[model samples]
Target: MQHFLNSSFTIPAERNEQLESLLKIHCHVFPYPAKTKFLEYGDAMDGVYYVFQGRTKHYILAEDGAEKILYCLSSGWFFGETPLTLHEPTGLISETMEPSILWKIPYSVYDKLLDVNKLFRTAIMNCMSRKMLIMRHEIENQVFNPCKQRILQLLCSTVDNASLVEGKWYNLSSHYTQYEISTIIGSARVTTSKLINELCNEGFIRILNRKLQVSKIIYEEITDQMDLL
Candidate 1:
């Protein structure tokens, strides 16, 4: 249900209710210690997860003081697959949002189970494809878009395609700092802050509660890019 909440399109209520029941069929539902920085990029994770309760943020850091937020996961989403299939590392910095509960399983064990139940392999392949596509989209957004526009676009996109009513506003939940945004957007802190003020003056976005709040114009600009998409 939460995954679909950030989706580009609507989903049926019944399907939302069914996610939990279906998740139990594949992974171990157990509490995991908080602050666990699990598998990283290029390394392997033995299995994927359907986070039953918890939050994790996926981010990549560059030595030059750049940080790109790749994606975030919460309950009802699955992550960590390379260890399970290719027997490789996850190769990303994954941090838990709190004391968490997750449905996890081992890939090697899954392979053994799949030797008899071939259908599981097919399911894994499909899930992997979707996750890869999402990663690609995140890279594309940061690579080409301007920081202020990109931030507005991302917030609006995550809010599920609805236009912000004129004057409607709220702060970013993550409290993502300007330094962090600069790192993620591949810009310097000064440049990012300048762009942000420009956005505010132009009536496209603003800082409220020390967080970014976008206007309908910002939303329009984002959709304009997709008009080309």
Candidate 2:
């Protein structure tokens, strides 16, 4: 309900009311502090975690102890479902990117909602389908694209919803470190840094106050390359 924060589609008010009613009984909402781990690898998926506010990253710990970021989530996405649905240990770590309000709803409640709420089920399915598509694109980026292209794609995805001012995209940075970005794009930190500098010199992107703004020309160029891909 109320567009469910980061969701692309808005749920009908009635369906939202139904969901909220259940949440009142079965969900415990609380503020999770910044830099905290919401869930960790091998943790049991006892409930679904929802983002009422703030951002989070879902990552996996590499064998070498580096973090391999799977994706960043903001405001609307649900996590902890993998272990919940499959009855396996969590494969990823969910950490708060900032201070966040989270809802933890028990599996029993989730099951009850699914049994009785058609709209909620549909919304979950839609979200899952979109996530699957994102996974496919990520695989393609890792396997076929060069590091620069991969980084570009990653940046574009991060800023897709950023506000535009005078035809430039803004508020795309500060959410991640270069190393974290390198991990997500399957590149080295040094390489990512160098590429970022190159882009800056070329006037493709601008960084100010730790935020990134993509020039319209650069945006079009990236889109063109993506189309060709």
**Candidate 2 global TM-score:** 0.83
Candidate 1 deviant stretches above 4 angstroms: 1-19, 29-36, 40-44, 63-65, 112-123, 160-167, 170-175, 217-229
What would the per-residue lDDT of candidate 1 be over residues 1-229, giving only the tens digit for each residue?
2221222111111123444544466667667676686656565565776566766666777776356656666655556765556566666787675678877766655666557654455555655665666556556655765566555554555442343444465443344567656654557789878887887888776776676766655555656665665
Which candidate leads the pack in lDDT?
2
lDDT of 2 by residue, 94-186 (tens): 888799888888888777777797855765666566666557667766787788766665565455445776666555533567887787777
Off by over 4 Å in 2: 1-25, 160-162, 165-169, 224-229
TM-score of each prediction:
0.67, 0.83
Q: How many residue pairs clash (N, CA or C atoms closer than 3 angstroms) in each of the candidate models, in the order given?
A: 16, 0
Instruction: Score candidate 1 by TM-score against the native.
Output: 0.67
